[model samples]
Target: MLHPEIQAKARAELEGVIGLDDNGHIPRLPDFEDRPKTPYLEYILLETTRWAPLSPLGVPHASTNADEYKGYYIPAGATVFANAYAMSRDERYYSSPEEFNPDRYIPVSEGGRGEPHPEGPFGFGRRVCPGQHLAMAGVWICIATLLATMELKCPVDEEGKELRPTVGFSDGLSGVPDAFGCRMVVREEAMELLGL
Candidate 1:
């Protein structure tokens, strides 16, 4: 379950841009048309995906049969993987990859002028993520609603230092970040808007 604070925050943001049809009644949920009005929401999606990739190493690409290309011999059943983590962190692609800077996605132009390569996270070719649009839209809505109302705070230890959360991962066919913790705070007005 989401922290109450987080839920409240999302409600607040949703109420604002969702707007009223002049009848004092809540309108339908946000849509793409409302995207221009809520840029930060989209940034949240990009940041989340970048911070925790769907696949640390993208789906493996394999050769169907033995062949030679670029003077390299290919054997059938050869295991391959595209490094999603490296691609995301490439100095050529992102500036200050270590820092969590959502501003990197602020640009609306094609490929995010700031990104080293003009490509979004879904990837390329016939093997690209089939659900890119659906995933992006889902993330966009969730983030937009969340930021609209709540404030996220990092948990701190007794030493008065913010918790340094780490992504625990295992070596295997799939890589996933381990569990971590954080704090959430929701303001009063935000909750009222969300109707929570």
Candidate 2:
């Protein structure tokens, strides 16, 4: 069940925009255009993707033939793995790289690169994720609705260690956070007209 406290925060944000709480029965479901106004949710979506990247190591690529990349000779049939996780955490690309803060994606200007480091590690050139648009849309919608009407909070146990998420993962294809518990709350009024 969603936690009430988190819900309150989301609801507050919603009310600030939507002005009513009809049990989340808003005028319409969220969409892409709502992104600018619902910027926080966008950050949440990107952060979620960064936090638990779909693939720790992105799709593997093989060198088709002998070629010189930079100064090194890469022979044919060489296997390569792109570390999305590492890129996301690179200090050159991110500030406070180890923290789980999601505000990195929020744009600093009208047409500028936003926070959360815009340099994507989704694979290079043609090998990039084929479903990038679909994936982003799914993530955006899910996050939008959540931020629109729900809150997420970390849960603590009796010892109060703040239960760190598992560092290692089983999937050789990707790196993912280990199992951890957190509280999710539904906000009473976290939606708005948006005028989109």
Score every model by TM-score: 0.68, 0.68
lDDT of 1 by residue, 1-196 (tens): 1233434444555666786545454545466677776654555556656755767777778878888868988899897666777777877767887665656775647446454322435666887879888888877766665555446666789987877676566665466667877776664445555676
RMSD in Å for all candidates: 5.6, 5.8
Q: 1-196 in candidate 2: lDDT tens per residue?
A: 2234434444454445544445554554456666566555555556656666778778888989988867988889998777787787778767777665555665778553465543454666876768787888877777666656556766768987555444545677755546767766544343344432
> Count of backbone clashes for each model?
4, 18
CA lDDT of each candidate?
A: 0.63, 0.61
TM-score of 1: 0.68
Q: Which segments of model 2 are wrong by more than 4 Å?
A: 1-29, 108-116, 156-171, 190-196
For candidate 2, what is the TM-score?
Answer: 0.68
Quote the RMSD, in angstroms, for model 1: 5.6
Off by over 4 Å in 1: 1-32, 66-73, 108-113, 116-123, 156-164, 167-170
